[model samples]
Target: MSVQDSAETAVLVSEWRDLLARHAATACALDRELSERFGLCMSDFEVLERLAEAAEALRVQELAEKVHLSQSALSRLIGRLEKAGLVQRAMCEADRRGIYVTLSAAGDERYQAARPLHREVLARSLAGHRPAGG
Candidate 1:
């Protein structure tokens, strides 16, 4: 590659890293805020949001993928939510071995309450990063 190409690649990589750092910082701030205000962590908020968006109950494996958590970790998270009455688990009708998770009414309420906070944090974080016009 030419020197110009190398410089461009370095700049791209740096931009990517900056984007990741910004995401992490914003998520951490949101997590702390949500935990303090709603007694829910970031992961819990993510799960609740995802379930609320799904048309029907989501399988454990599928939910794990959507939330970017390992299956075992997701299972543990689901267990906590279940114990808190935020979500419920049922066996999939077609696959008796597969467990599906559905958001409970309480979970929906919690998600509704937290959604605005999530959006505000995201909007504030991204607003500073956007290009001047486009």
Candidate 2:
């Protein structure tokens, strides 16, 4: 690599590393607090919340897109939730091969229970950074 290009790349990488680290630290702290306060892992909380918000059961592909997860990874996560009795899976009527996932009543209750802590922590974290008009 050319010397100038190498140096620029190094600088960019360093900046990106710091940016990523800061966000990671924030997320880790929030996750730890959430777990301690509500006994919910971030992933579990995310899935439950997504399911609770849906008017109907979500297709696996739709859930994967919303959660920013690969299909396989989402499937594994759903399996865990299913085991926990927080979610139930059903065959899609129109597409027999497609799976639809729905939050169980237990899952809905858990999400509702955790909602306050989730909102409080998130708000507290972001309050300092809110734009003046927004």
Best by TM-score: 1
TM-scores for all candidates?
0.91, 0.80
Tens digit of per-residue lDDT, candidate 1, span 1-134? 99999999999999999999998988898898899888888999999999999999999999999999999999999999999999999998888999999999999999999999988888887777978885
Candidate 1: global Cα-lDDT? Answer: 0.94
- What residue runs in model 2 are displaced by over 4 Å at the alpha carbon? 1-19
What pairs collide in candidate 1?
A: none
Q: Could you tell me the C-alpha RMSD of candidate 1 in Å?
A: 1.8
